[model samples]
Target: MKKLRNNTALLMMTLPGLLLLIAFHYLPIGGILIAFKDFSYSGGTFLKNFENSPWVGLKNFEFFINTPDAYIITRNTILYNLVFIVLGTAVAVALAIALKELRNQRSAKVYQTFILLPYFLSWIAVSYLFFGFLSADKGLINNLIMEPLGFHPIEWYSVKAYWPYILIFANLWKYAGYNCIVYLATITGIDPDYYEAASLDGATKWQQIRHITIPSISTVITLLVLLGIGRMFFADFGLFYQVPLNSGAVFEVTNVIDTYVFRALMNSGDIGMSAAASTFQAFVGFILVLLSNFIVRKIDKEKAIF
Candidate 1:
């Protein structure tokens, strides 16, 4: 009782945050029931509507699975995330190492700020920026590069073939710098004694980086990769939806699970189906996190997130 009294102020400070978490995250979990029901409005209170809805079991889930485009969306979601994780991690780590090698702190700070600026911009803003470069008639790319090179201007939005590379590059530009910051923090925390000892032993800079820097941060790299694997089934809705201007021509390549669900919800007003899709995503993500953690435990017990 005396111990509780001693920490009363600190506990009071945490009360609001705890309440917010419970209200937003834990409280809404009961609404997962709507996914299993034929939810419909009956001109009543929201809770009354849910209560009146008939239970439909797995029908909603089956509808999503049996759709013709199901395979395409699932494949795109997983593949894009895999590419993002692999390429993003490599680029972020390389950038972090390069930043560490910079002798001038001011120049390094400026470069870091410039790289991180993209991450703060909304996807809506980025879509307009991309439009300025890829517009068919007046785009900078066609007017400046294609015209000067004696080539015809190509229609960017109408072409499906180029979207895969375009989406990947845009994803990297926005997110790579944020990931680099995490790696840079890990790199900064390394003890100086290891590098000093390596230098004394006549190790080249590349050798030191390969043997010392990489090894030192291997655990952090593994943790981040595992966390990424948990969300492999999810995609950034805005990136796939807004960046391509919702062009039907590019839907074959850019349509992901999230975008597909959004389109379905908008076109059909099927709340039950939308709920099922979200539940499916959440369930798959949970399983992936567990499976990935189990694999990590088998390989290295200490590195397992659990």
Candidate 2:
């Protein structure tokens, strides 16, 4: 009787969070069924009547696979994310190491706050800021750097060749600081006695970091890498869409799964096809996460997400 009462009381305390999860996350998941339907507005409301919306199981998937844009968007999405995962983590780790060396708390905090500020900015806002620097005519790069050096002002938006570098650099610049803070927290949580003992053993700075610091943080690093791998099949909508300013000229390089789906749905109103793309993405992401978890467990049992 006491256990039953405690369970009910615990349920009551958690009811609000459970309700929020159902309201926001699980309830909307049913909308995923639209991927397999030839949706139309004939139904006054989509949820009220899924019966009138005929199901065409595999057609949408077929169409998206056959799409010419499929190769480009998928490649771009995967490649960009891979670069972000590697370069972003590298930058973060480096920054975390540097921050760990700082004994002064105030200076460290100031630098950290400044670095993390960029992560809070919206993609659209960052896009405009980047435009101010890269704009062909009056951009800071052209007006202040290239033109001053008697070079041509390259049309950044119209140019596809430069976007990969731009995107990777932008991703690092915006998110590295935030990610480094996580790494720094992990680093700080390590026992100072490890470093002190290393010093007693005549360990140099590099040796201390190499043997003690890197190995200590390996678990967190592995966890973050696993999470990155899980999301490998997805793309950031704003990074691909807003950062390049949605210039059609740059679509060859910048087009990604999210933007491609948005275009297909909004422009062509192919709800079925767009839903298929989304479903495909979600399915792949799910499988990848499991596969990733398995791989992580094999490499380091302690680091696995499971």
Candidate 3:
């Protein structure tokens, strides 16, 4: 009776949020079936009137597989995400360790706040800020620095070659501090007695970090990596789209599945096809998550997300 009362109370408190989630997230899942059907606005909400709309099961998937750009977009998505996962984690881990060494807690928190500020800024805003530095015509980079050094002011937008480095740098700047805070939290949770013992053994700071900090946080790092790997098929839409500003020349390096889907939806206005693309992304992400967690379980069962 006590457990049932507690459960009922919990349900009462959670009902509103549950309804909101259903309205926003789970309720929309029905649209995923549109990918398999010839969904039409004229056909009403459930997409009736198939005789007019028509069904093309597996055709969209086939279309994507046969397209030459499939390999390219797939490659770009995987490569960019892989790099972000590896480098982002490493850099964040390092910063977290370094910050933990600071004696003044308030000063450390202030520095953390400053570092995390950029993450709250929109990517579109970042794009314009970057324009001031890289814009070919009147950029400060050209007038003040590159020109002073007698180098030509390269047209950054028109050039596809530079986007790889540009994307990596942008990602690092925006996410490194945010990610570091997670590792920092894990680091702070460690028992101080371990560190005290290491110090008593005359361990240097670097040695202590290498021997203690990294090893202690390895489980958290592994869990994070597994979570990241699950979303390997996904890409940040703004980071890929707004950052490049739809430059046709740079599409080779910047185009990913999400951007391609956006372009198709905007141009074709084909709800079914767009749904198919989105469903594809969700499916890939789902499978990757399971696969990654399985691998984690194999290596270290305790660290697996499941």
Which pairs clash (backbone N, Cα, C closer than 3 Å) in model 1?
none
Candidate 1 structure quality by residue, lDDT tens digits, 120-230: 999999999999999999999999999899999989999999999999999999999889998999999999899999999999999999999999898999999999998
What lDDT does the true structure give each of the candidates? 0.94, 0.89, 0.87
How high is each candidate's TM-score?
Answer: 0.95, 0.92, 0.91
Q: Candidate 2, TM-score vs. the true structure?
A: 0.92
Best by TM-score: 1
Which tens-of-lDDT digit does each residue in 182-249 have in candidate 3? 99999999999989999999999988999999999999999888778877878989899988888989
> Which pairs clash (backbone N, Cα, C closer than 3 Å) in model 2?
none
Clashes of 2: 0
Ranking by lDDT: 1, 2, 3
Give per-residue CA lDDT, model 2, range 194-290, as digits (tens): 9999999999999998999999999999889878877886888988899898999999999998999898889988888887888898789789889
Query: lDDT of candidate 2?
Result: 0.89
After superposing candidate 3, which stretches have Cα over 4 Å from the reference? 1-24, 42-52
RMSD of 2: 2.5
Model 3's TM-score against the true structure? 0.91
